[model samples]
Target chain A: MTSQLEALRRELDRINEEILKWLNRRAEVVQEIGRLKLKQGINRFDPVREREMLDHLVRINTGPFDDQTIRALFKQIFAASLKLQQKQHEDALLV
Target chain B: MTSQLEALRRELDRINEEILKWLNRRAEVVQEIGRLKLKQGINRFDPVREREMLDHLVRINTGPFDDQTIRALFKQIFAASLKLQQKQHEDALLV
Candidate 1:
């Protein structure tokens, strides 16, 4: 029983680590998108793209959480990516 | 050594769960703030409050990541919470 519990705990740890790794990768890609938006002089907040991404995630999601929650999570993610890009822009100006 | 590792892993998992619970609580407050803003006819984006939160988070952060990263993370979180509030507003309007 102890060993079984150990195995399950390890599995959860592995999954959590994988989730964080994927989140980092997602942040990197979003940063790239922010750079593209900056280069094109487009608004950081793109409702159309955001809506599409949320819709896609909602359609594909089958999980412990609901679609709205997932969409809300992603929306926060995009906002954070945009802020990072903006910070980079400010740093470049200061330099 | 395996037992020690198991203990550490369980600790991290517990921390992760606590973090998620706190996030939910934060979202609830943000929702309340959103409704108040609507009632008083205020903007959703409050630069002063946001800047203050980020600054506080950065000041309090002590970790593997830098202050900027911490601030960036919180900014994303606030954005997500705001999005949830906005969605709630829209739902109310639709009904």
Candidate 2:
């Protein structure tokens, strides 16, 4: 029983590690997009694109997490990513 | 110009999909752990374990995300997963 918990925890930890790496990768891509947008004088936050992405993710979701939960979690990540972009843009302006 | 944005958006979309899948996989593991806890009559939330996980994630993080942001995002995921577990446990009792 204890060993079962150990094994499950290990798997959970592994999954969390993968997620951390992927989230960082996603942030890197967002950073690149932000740089491009700044160069083009385009706004960084694209609500239409975000809505479409969320919709697609919700549609494809098969879960122990319901669609709403999936939407909420991803939305937090998206919001954070946007914040990071805005901070970068601000820092660039100050330079 | 447009092509570059398009390419970046595609990569972002792909990474989002991957993250979505990984989140679900993580949820599945959480469910297993939940079941084990339920069987053992143990409390569902483990603050010490959670603290450990977050600390390890923070230490390993190399990011466009600051450690606080990493903690916040994972905490949200962890909270949601705990809710999922509780809901399952309640449903089990109803059966």
| DockQ of every predicted complex | 0.03, 0.92
For residue B7, give model 1's deviation from the true position in Å: 0.5
Who wins the TM-score comparison? 2
Model 2 lDDT per residue over A4-89, tens place: 99999999999999999999999999999999999999977889999999999999999989999999999999999999999999
Q: Write the per-residue lDDT of candidate 1 for residues A1-95, one digit (tens) a residue.
A: 24543453344333333334334444555555555556667576667755765676566555334466766666665565566667766766687
TM-score of 1: 0.50
Judging by lDDT against the true structure, name the best candidate.
2
Relative to the unseen true structure, what is the C-alpha lDDT of residue B43 in candidate 1, on a scale of 0 to 100? 70
lDDT for residue A20 in candidate 2, whole number 0-100? 98
The residue-by-residue lDDT of candidate 1 on B11-78, one tens digit each, is 43343343444455556556666666666666766678567656655555443334665566666666
| CAPRI quality band, candidate 2 | high
Over the true interface, candidate 1 deviates by an RMSD, in Å, of 12.7
For model 1, state the Cα shift of residue B40 in Å: 2.0
State each model's CA lDDT, in order: 0.55, 0.94
lDDT of 2 by residue, B1-95 (tens): 59999999999999999999999999999999999999999998899999999999999999989999999999999999999999999999999
